[model samples]
Target: MSFKSRTLLFVICLFVVSNKLVATPKVKTIPIFNIQVDSLIEQQSIRNDMTQLELLVLYNDALKEKKPADSVNIFKKLAILNADLGQPEDALIYTEKYIKNTLDFSILNSEAYNVIRGSEAHKELSENYMLQIDWISFIFLYVALIGFFFTVIINFSKKANRCAKLFISGFVGVHSLFILEFVLYISNIQYRLPHTYLIAALTALLYGPFLYLYFKSVTYNFKFRTIDLLHFLPTLILIVYLFPMYSLSSNDKIEIMLEINNSYNINRYVIFISKVVSLFIYAILIGKFHYSRRKEEDSIKGKKPVNRWKKTIYAIHVIYLVSYIIYGLPVSGLMLSFPYFINYIQVSIMSVMVIYLAYMAYVQPEIFKSYSVGTSENTIPPLEKYQKSGLTNALSEELKGNLIRLFVEDKVFKENNINLEELSKRLNTTRHNTSQIINEHFNINFFELINKFRIQEAIRILKEDIHGSLNIIDIAYEVGYNNKVTFNKAFKKETSLTPSEFINMQIKKGLYK
Candidate 1:
């Protein structure tokens, strides 16, 4: 066949196949009885005075219909109604059906579930079903925590600061224990790890101290001292007191677990309360420190106000304090008395907090500038002679004027990737000379100097375009910022007001249309 004939044949074959695939009819099965059941359920559910017996009748009819998905919803309604009517055993049976059909174990720790857990009828179902299905949540938390821990580790490795490293390490240790406990619980092998409870108890004692250290380290640039070891005394004492549990026989360990589980041990309650009290104290201390730091920064002139890192750390502490009050205190026995679903809700909140923490840590700004850390004053002579380079004072003055002209008239600072090397090249000078001049004259790093000009330009534009001609994001890009977040941060740092707030202030002053 010729080329055109062969191509035509292939096209015809593809078109026929495509049409057949598109025109094919789909097969679906529908349960005729489920339609009637759904209609009845919807009608009864909407009625103001539906009786428990009527709900039970619907549930029985749903079971006889043998439609698993529809029956599951009916079983859930029946469970709630039976429990309300004080028929816990019947409620539990229906709850089990709902859980099995839906693969949801959120009700495993409910009062009704607890009532039937020890009963002979639901023993296997309660123990096996609860653990098996809950493993899904456990695995998710485990993986997420591991990822968070390593993320912090990567941050610590880059900076190599003792205080921050220890702070993050302590948190990783605590989270590791949580993962281990979940593992043992879900695997039904907690007794094999007999020392788990004692270790967890001891670890809990470090939670408040480590958190305190983390805030202290970031806010105050703390250095670890011998006195700092005293903070671990409480954790040590806990380990010593629980030392006996470490060597207990398997049977004895099981008894201790039972006692702890039943809240029969007064010491366990005491430890929990102590941890909460300690965290509260640290939170107050950190709040005071933050206030002092803010006051100190406010006193400095020509410096950008608002330390975002400090605020982020302080917010984390606030979250910790609130979480302890909600989920830690004994008087806040809400978690215990509430449904099992409440536990998962708490877990979800903590997971979000962890993710936020990881994000903040990952993007934490440089605490120390490059020249501030390793370079010494003696290494470079005084700025008067331009030191080892032999550049005269007159020439340095000329270069400074030229640099100002480039920034002010040329508007070179608007470029997103402007840096010392680029600036040095523009000035036809060595990078070292350019950096020294910026440090000595401006008393700031290259990035800070660039951002200062950009922020000033942004303010000018905001004032000129008054009738909201350009939105905050558009203004950010127009002023040389590549993204809105960095622009907002820089603007707020310089002016102590967000872009929107600045625009509003301009409008109030009649500077903007």
Candidate 2:
């Protein structure tokens, strides 16, 4: 109750009240022991007040100690702590460092890091670091690589149609490069090498044109005219439009790529939509050409030339067209969503086309031969015997086609006096050029070619029930063989059987009525 004691009690009470009002700064405790992952993880969860600076110190200590596991754990903790603190840029840097050390993407999906999920830096981190190789990507890469070699083989092939093969090679080459670019995108290498960004995009314009050219060349023996070069205008324009981007430095390009919003780019949408349009238009053109040729073949009833191959190719074109449209819808922003797996459908269809082309090139190359036989003679040196001949390749090809038509369709070989001079007159060429065409194109002399056709005709007559009544001499004269002896000799040479023996075999097999 003394006044001095009352004043001392009041002062003590005031000091306690001031200490409670102005709180002490909580000290960040550092363990004297070495940093360990298990202890840090427990502390990170329990010590919610832990600062990123404390985690950074622990991460640097782990690195100095050459403990990779502890360093990666600290990096992840720093990333999450920064993300929760609303510092997405800092969080992204730490996230990338963590992923580089651990190759783990699980942290990206953790709800604890949601604050940074929509950040450009975070997106770059996910895209650049979350590298994966899907099985479909591998398959596309493998098939495209094989397509490259096959393209080379056919491009250099001397036996098939030169113009048609060139277009086929172009088609395969473009698809292979496009698929390779896709593989790189899937593998996250596109971000590393910015130059590869639009390389595949331009190739889209080429696919339809190449396919059209191939169909035209094979069916109609089409040679490129000046107007045909217009098919490349779109691709060339795209190249010019993209040139500015292509000229940018790698660092600048990557900066642009990392900042690009998920929304559609008008220029990109237009370019891609045009490609789909080009494909659609060319598909119709190719289908029209193919149908017209098919109708002609059907009317003539001559042996169909690569009819099956042409049909298969057109069918594949249609399939690819549908798949590409579906895949392009979302990618070009015509549709709402782009499921990444949708690309697999189009790429698989392209792979099938590539494989089918390889099959045709290997198994049925003869069907690809065009009417312009030996047109590649300019590239390949002429044979020694024909080096001095006056037969130009174009003229020789014309004569050869006509001569084949004469024998196979017109049955001119059934004429008893169808000598080289007579055949040359019918072909409207010099006897020497006609003779050279036979030797160079068919690898046989004029008489040998005529005799071979005659023998074939005689065999056909011998096996036919209607012609079974014709005797050997009568058949010999009918097939342009003046005598039975010459007919028997030619038949024996062609089929290892005389005319009488061929008829007997047919009779024994019940081929004749």
Among all candidates shown, the one with the greatest TM-score: 2
Q: lDDT for model 1, on a 0 to 1 scale?
A: 0.63
List residue ranges in candidate 2 displaced over 4 A: 1-77, 80-128, 260-266, 298-305, 372-513
Give the distance in Å from residue 115's predicted Cα in candidate 1 to where it truly belongs. 21
RMSD of 1: 23.8
Q: Which window of 10 residues has the lowest lDDT sum in candidate 1?
A: 366-375
RMSD of each: 23.8, 13.8
Candidate number achieving the greatest lDDT relative to the actual structure: 2
- The superposed Cα distance between candidate 2 and the true structure at residue 66, in angstroms, equals 30
How many steric overlaps does candidate 1 have? 1
lDDT string, candidate 1, 1-513, tens digits: 999999999999999999988872221123335456546556555443345556565556567775565577677777765655556678767876775555455655555444444565456555544444465556645655664565457454554456666675666557455545655655545644555645556676676677667656644446789999998987788777767656666556655554433323436556667777777777787677667666444323222222455576567657755755665543344345544444444445445545555555556533311111122421222344445766677877878888899999999988777888999999999887787677656656678889889999998888778677888898888778999999999998787799989888888888865
TM-score, each model?
A: 0.51, 0.55
Quote the lDDT for 383 in model 1.
48
